[model samples]
Target: MENATPSRTALGVARMRALHQFSPQAGLFRDPYAIAILGEAAPAAQELEQEDERRQRMRLFVASRARFAEDWLAAAVLRGVRQLVVLGAGLDTFSLRNPYRDLSVFEVDHPATQAWKRKCIADSGLAEPAATRFVPVDFERQSLSAELAAAGLQSTAPAFFIWLGVVPYLTKEAILKTLSWIAGVPGSEVVFDYSEPAANRDAAGQAALAFHAARVASVGEPWISFFVPAELAISMGELGFDEIEDIESGDIAARFSEAPKGMTNNSGGGHIIRARRTA
Candidate 1:
């Protein structure tokens, strides 16, 4: 999150996605551009083959969340949603692989990260879809609503938002504010992931959380928010989201991925949720 520098965590997540490409279980959610998008930074086959339990769990979760979000998005498109806004889009290839020709995809991210993504895309020789619009806004300094509005996002129409790998990094107030904005769009839907408080986690989960927290903090992006599932669901309901699907960690792999043999689902307290504003 340092000024003028792309997020290190973003790059790390991208690497995980790249590693998943080499997974035999990739049929669950194939991202052909996942490795190519990273250009030279893509993980070597050796790295993919030698992944430990923790990294394997992380990789599957990342892929599962994307699968969950996109499955919901396909349903939204059928329901007449045209706008697809990717909040905190970090080297995500959804826009490139979009099957809905009419869907307008918006990639929203920090200016530094956005710039870096553009460079990577260009260097990788991947053609960005014409419908993909990049909106650069530093959430700390700029107004998301204002920036999206100026970038041709229709406020009057419903838009589907995919906010992944971002909620835990934001304060509760900021999270509510953003959700409130999404609620204002009639029939809007959003898919996002969040983690529960350490207290709610099992002993093994807490140990994993501590390690990951310290790692991210060392890179200057310490997680600042954790939500209890029921409380977060209530808050979303208050924001006008009538239908909510909360998928816990244990369920994610079963729901999305064809787990590799002996793959233990040790995803800790992470959860992926999809909320809809029907009214």
Candidate 2:
């Protein structure tokens, strides 16, 4: 997916979050910057519609999980975590709307995507936050630690990482390398989402996965890796995480607002996991 245009999936995700803003009241979470980040492409993004029922379900999951991650980050910040690192931060507006006064924010993504996002920010006439730093990185070609350090990230301090919309697009080895590295840092906690293996899915869920998987593959960033919830928990334990909270889609829906009509919050499709290293 290197040297490709900014991910279509990213644009779709941004659109989903932007739609949440229009929901009655504040919706799952408020992000006024979500639509602005689309810039001149806002109308084009709005015009891009999901023609299939399964695709619509997939879109709801995107917004739901984004809400989940942001809520968790807010709680983490309340506990005195002063740093936030966002991985694969495609069109994410958390940095722009960050409410914590003392928190430092970092946005990490592919160079090409980051460049496109910068242009979008400039076109929107929104000033980037002074505390927010962007680190252009290709995980396969460079070291995340080295890149973050070069960008002024403190390795010795506690930090919270928000990793969403990128795990399933990566390989098992790549995911492990990144997670293991995070575990090595003291007081590091990461909240990320991942798809469950097909064996765990029912017939309808499996069909939905097939449709969504094919759609992403067509865009060059296919779903390459998956995990069983049990196996994933064990893997995190082996990696030295002192605490692991595995939340499925159904749980997420119940914890948040009611699901809209025809919205299928299937846990078999994906999960949001938070792991923390206290030692």
Instruction: Name model 2 segments beyond 4 Å from true.
Output: 23-26, 43-52, 261-268
Best by TM-score: 1
Residue-wise C-alpha lDDT for candidate 2, range 1-279, written one tens digit per residue: 657677777877787666556544236567778777886555333433533555445556677777778887888888888989999999998888888888999999999898888888988998889999999999777899999999988988889999999999988999999999999878899999998877789887787678778878897888999999899999999999989998877665567664554453573477889999887
Decoy 1 TM-score against native? 0.96
- Candidate 2 local lDDT, residue 65: 78
lDDT score of model 2?
0.81
Scored by CA lDDT, what does every candidate get?
Answer: 0.88, 0.81
- Cα-based TM-score, every candidate: 0.96, 0.92
Task: Please tell me which predicted candidate would have the highest lDDT against the true structure.
Answer: 1
What overall lDDT, based on C-alpha atoms, would model 1 receive against the true structure? 0.88
